[model samples]
Target chain A: MDFSAVRSVAVLPFHDLVGDTRAADRVRDTYMGMLLATRAVYVLPSGEVNRGIARASIRNPQQPTTDEIVKLKKELGVDAVITGVLREYGKVRSGSAEANMISLSLQMSETQTGSTIWSGSSTKGGISLADRMLGTGGRPMNDVTVQVINDLLDQLFE
Target chain B: MICSTSCSNRFLLLPLALLVVLLLGGCAGLEHTTVSSSGNTDLPARLEEGALYALLPIENLSASRAPLAELDMQLRNALKERGIRLLEPERLETFMREQRMRSRGGINLTQSRALRDLGVAGVFITALETWREGEVPRVSLIMRLVQSGDEPEILWIDGVGRTGDEAPGLLGLGLVKDVRQLTAGALERLLDSFVAARSGAEPGTAAQKKRHQPKYRYRAADFDPAAEYRVAVIPFLNVDTREHAGRIVGLHVVRQLQRYGNLKVLEPGLVREALLSQRMIMQEGPSLEAAELLAAADVLGADLVVSGRVFAYEGDAGESKVDFSLQIFSGIEPQVIWTSHSYGGGDDGVYFFDRGRVPSAHELAGRLAEAAIGDFAQ
Candidate 1:
């Protein structure tokens, strides 16, 4: 697959399958940073696309179709679209710290071809300050999310 | 041989008719009946020692990618730790399978019947939304208690929690982490309210013992209608940007408190008058001096004063998002008797400006008010 041609990308608001506002925010920020790192690509604002998708009720789907994806791409005006699903959002109590975990899968598709070019997923865990304050080393949710986003971007950009 | 065959057919027909009559008689006997005894039997009134509750799988209303199972488990564990008896999930699963029940969805009536048949005193059901926004994970959970044999009476509690900005490390780490944190926090609040109602103790009571009595211990007749209890509702502060949100929320609190039917609800017009006479606007914060405010209607003699803050409101987008906390104070001295917080929202923003979305909020308020009244009666 020729990745160089995918210079202009549109980021969709990460759909929260888990409905956790915090996890959604983390994924959005991480994806924003990853897109920004790709200087060659022009990324559209996710909020605008999300608003349009929501207004049209196309973001929520039992099974999204190719035509729907293509339409969304045309409406949002982007050559490629980055979409992902949030799989999990939770915390585990370790020794003395609580380890928060978040998992996501990202899929990039070419609007014209209607074909998925790249797909990958990552899960990251972090410890909170409360856990560290209690002398327990735990990974915070934010740290793990950043790492996962970086890894996913490296795979796609490389 | 012809006569013998005819006789055999008659015999079979007679038996069939008899069987049909017996079946019809049995059906007729199943009519609703009530039993009354002239005198109360001295069969040692056994106090209900403890209640066993079964929490069914919570229906996921948000996106499908969320870890809903883990969140349900977390809530179950939180309730179990409070010394409340909970039915094991595996057992529940086996029982549900035996009953040919596949999903918790559309099982509201069936579930109530099953719990009653199982002889459980209470059943807990929940609905959850787990979603990610930006780098933060948000979880919205609504838990309710349906008493056995009580068709319409339900106690509801709703809560929302968010995880700090972070991502998942493993295949299901993020979902699990967010679910656990959010469910745990919600369970804590719910258990606290449940325990408080059961023991008639205020929050932070360490030595309270579980009361082994039925929920409806006090009847409406037990309250003295002649005794007028002065009640006041302070202006609920609005944390959200919605204008007049505080007044609307405050009115709701006042309405719920008045519904007790035992006490006279002070008119909203009179309350406004009292505030004006005191040179106080609704913009002012809650007042602790019940005596000063009572000059209009004997505030010092008030049995309870309800006050709270509106932390959020339904936006113009139709999302039913709202957060409010309430506290019931006893006497003019302002001693806290009971306190509760409720949060509600949805993704489509359709919950706001919609009466249907308000049901969840109303249920929570009713439960909280019931608890408050239970304390006063005790």
Candidate 2:
């Protein structure tokens, strides 16, 4: 349960389960930014991670397998790899025309054994009373995203 | 008080039943309305579609992202169907993911670097105004193409809108459909412009489009567009009611000039910096006497200064209106080289609203920007 040795981590592409690849990418990024802001670990440069993905010749970057993580660790020289699945990201509407829904889950795994060290999931950014009454919708995805990431990281870091 | 069975609860039952009926009957009045977005562009022919192109995320202005997200996917499929080769979305998303994290959500060097790494010929950026599903559908999409590199240069742009020809609903019971058919129809016509430009063929969808042309006037008759000059466009003196109208219009003018691929337009940031160094706020309109312009231009290392004012900008989902004036000053002499005044609005809010000509504020702004540039930009 100790992440004391987790000095460095690299965030990989998240699986876009709901067919919205952009939402998946966006949510994964918020997670990465939150992780970086923690100053908890030396997050490997995104450029290096991109290069590692390319070097590994991963056909489906969305679902990075254990071997790919091992390869990324070797190339990027990171201790752990961060990856996640985006179950549901984007909006649901009842003629309101507002994006007030988001859902995602993430995890950080040990590279050598591909064993999960820490994991977190969140389903936030939903409609509220004010949204329906005013027809204005709920909080923007960005703000809600920060809250979601904070919740996830708190579970992992604490 | 908690009602035991039927005595006190009878009163609550009536109100609850009424509420349910009201909610159910609310949609009975759902009237079907047709909204169209007509778009045509002057994009040149002879594009290399087989070469690599990158599609950035579309800017969703309609407060919701799901519809636009679907539109983005539809656009990719549509363009691919039209024989355009796009950089794999996974790789592009990967690059952007890093860019977001490293730049902390700002436009940074990563886009340029990613463009280089991907070895793309062009980048496709777009804005989705209205995309939804129903018997009577609405769609407005504007696409902007920029030639790739460190400094991505604008190549083409156009805004379009169109309404689905759906039959009237029986007491609001029917709405044709959503997503599949509506998106297919819109994307078919929308992406066709890319091919139309290259094949030198007229687009069938653009048949109803009404093109607008803006005129120009210059104070200095001898000012030449052929001259190689670095131009600076200061923030407009916005008299428009819209907040930040001046700043937005200035940016629009810069993009318009940049798209022309002529006239060395200095970065507005550089002009702002120079103005700041002079302890001057360049928010004033073109009335900046030629001497003041010359000083600002000289300090900013420019030969021409473009200044303007956005007098008005009004718009809604149905249509939009704008009025503005523009002027250009020569850095060497205290003389105004050129000036222009123009205004425009979509033909909307009429009995034939469906058949009328209505352009968005952005499209109208583009028209004004073109007029602002006039001969100089070309």
Candidate 3:
């Protein structure tokens, strides 16, 4: 339940609810990049995480067992793991030409215990009454995803 | 008292007459068609009320956005109503991720072991042929109920294709079914069919009593009939001069083996991924070395590993010939359990004055695949 001692974190691949893997990957990268910008917790790069996965020869990287977690701890030397599922993501079109939306759930867990310390999710990007009346669109998918990640991180920090 | 003998005939034909009139009235758009093939009726007895079964990712052939998840949810709800246990979606997802099996893809060997450890009876894999939602809703699905075993038996295989339904009329006058009614009705009917089969037939039926077990083609002493088994089919060794011949044949064999319902066939992707992870490069050969086969079985947790190789493939624009051989190796030990060599001729061989008919590579591979493992049905 403590984030003070969580100096470094590895974000695992997020499951794609919309089945658009490219969008999911982009969102995860955006989150990691934004988290890195805060300079609060040093984030492991996805490439490094992938190398660790290949090194561990994990059967299921997303659903790692306590034993697999132990291996990952030794292999990647990460204090915490951030896992997520992308629910609604990618570009959406409304009365306005094109808009983007993102709905995602995330959990940060200690690698040693695989115990969750914090969890959160958000759905963003919809046509407001103003936008509907003016015939305008909301932010693009990346911008919306970044905003959601930022807000969620703010909550975690608080 | 007033009915004559000829009058009785008129009454007998009344129902048929109504059906014809209904067809003429454009009621033909909604007669649901179902095709099913069932193995031993006793096979259903394997499903217990509370036994948990994993559902492999449903193969989505329809051009829809991840409807498999929604459809699977509906299916699980239907199953729950029947007191059937299913693997929790998250649990299955996590387990597959652990084993590196793709949700939209396959069942691997090691993943099968995990399912067993989780105390699952078997796995359900389906294919969505058509899933159109709207005014004229249509749903077509091919369902496979596979038993967990060394050769996982596909106990029940059913296919349904239906679009809307006729609305019920007063006194059988109107035959109309709404989209919601059609979907729910078809789903319930399919579930009932599965449950009834699993509940078992009356033990005293003549078919059950006769019990005609056909002669198996590749009989080896190690072919244990008692315990359920999962089989991992590694990419076949390609020996033909043509490229990807073995892979094509392997694909056909996997498809055919999948239809049998007695073997928990490992998805080819899982096998490929496993081999790649283990740094074991699958080469073009008739069979794997004992150690290599053991490694494959280790990764797949399969009881048996089916290895194959293509020997001959020759074809031009219109004619083709193919030959292939297969061998089953046990994961328990470093030995071949069974072996079969087969060959087949393909293409119509119709001669055109300038251009003769030629079989494509896939056509040849399919023929060879059928020839090699056709007896597996028995």
Candidate 4:
């Protein structure tokens, strides 16, 4: 893998299918780890992308369209826009939380052409620490996010 | 030889008599005989496995309609009789309260979590819709199945049973009877759809299905608790006539988020502080620059922002109802991580705040909180 070729990767806020704000945070948090792990890729801070999205006046930020994604990538001047969708999330029991069954669909495109070079999606589910203390049980949110991100990254890097 | 033959013949007679007596005794011990009764033998069991369901209090959405509460009770009982585990309305209400959540007009995350907790595979929400055709009476129903981890599928069943003139002609059937029949029909159809879906049959695939999935998790195993993230809860949009209803709902939700003691709750005060710091007015509705709000909260810098609205507050002359709709967005990109709507209803008909209904506002609040927490479970 040519690590030097990938630089300044931008992670767009993941789209929330259910519209719960917490799920979006979980996704961003999970993605942060992956970004940090990839030494070659310079990841843009999620906060910056969020601010840009908020400024864009888009409804349902978690589920933006391809066009909106293109516009965001251009505005941010990043190599790629990492987007995701929260497929399912919640605490099935009092403390046991299922954070994300993220359908992580990443589109790596030439920012100029808006043509997708690579796109892939993966479903992942996890439990939260609060859920564990509450005695509820499920997969951890981070685990799900990491797995989804890894799958997405593989598609993009490959 | 003659004596031996005579003895053997006596012994044979005694044994035959004994055998007859035993046979007669067995016959006498037999209870009532069951003759085959012919009926609807093919009728399926009322309750099926992996069927998620919701039992809603029937509401009269028509003029001069029958009380829906009674129908609600009856329908619940009927479903119970058929071996269905009816989602305890009281329990569901409690869970909602503990979570400090209110119902959005439709099935919210709280209900989904509660149902899932109850081991229900799906939910059946029943509502009454009534209208008049000239002087004749007409009644109908809108039933919806909120499947766990799937899209919301709705079914509308309608009809006219009897008019006032036809009512008298029938064998002592009244308005209640007519309404009950209509409800029974709606319930039957609801169950039919459930069974059909489980059996992998499509029931009106043309109808639009609304897919609702959760956005985030709160457990440590899911994410590092130490990982700092900024959550934004936008001012709830009110779909009701009540002023400040959105603020009330928003405050309650923010309080619940803080209670979780895990994720950092972006306080309304902080939102105000950030807005003021940015020299922007913290007013009604989502900020024109949502990104600014995200940045002010440091959400862009943090992890996620939560935002949504108070979509509806319905009440009659005596009772008050409140509904809140919410969504969590990624602070990085303001993506909605999760979404939920909760509702709270109370009877305020008689007593003032000091001596209100037996289930006082505090109790109602508690119930709403349970729902809020339970929604996460669902």
Candidate 3 or 4, higher TM-score? 3
By TM-score: ranked, best first? 2, 3, 1, 4
**lDDT, candidate 4, B204-283, per-residue tens:** 31111121111222311243334555555555555433554454445444434433324554434345434445664332
- Which scores better on lDDT, 3 or 4? 3
Off by over 4 Å in 2: A1-158, B1-49, B61-66, B100-110, B129-139, B163-186, B200-218, B226-311, B329-336, B348-356, B359-378
Report lDDT (Cα) of residue A59, candidate 3.
Answer: 79
Q: Per-residue alpha-carbon lDDT of model 4 for A121-149, expressed as tens digits?
A: 76665555755566445544444556777
Interface RMSD of each: 21.8, 22.7, 23.7, 10.9
**Candidate 1, B239-320: lDDT as tens digits:** 5336655655564455344434355444433354455556764332343343235533332235655555565554323233
* For model 1 chain B, the run of ten residues with the poorest summed lDDT: B31-40
Q: What are the per-model C-alpha RMSD values against the true structure?
A: 27.3, 22.0, 22.8, 23.1
Off by over 4 Å in 1: A1-158, B1-48, B98-110, B150-152, B156-183, B201-378
TM-scores vs. true structure, each candidate: 0.30, 0.45, 0.38, 0.28
Question: Highest DockQ: which candidate?
Answer: 4
lDDT of 2 by residue, B5-69 (tens): 66668878998987665544433212222221211233444256468887877766433334656
Query: Global CA lDDT of candidate 3, please?
Result: 0.59
Which ranges of candidate 3 are over 4 A from the true structure? Answer: A1-158, B1-32, B134-136, B147-155, B165-180, B201-378
In model 1, state the lDDT of residue A143: 50
Clashes of 2: 6
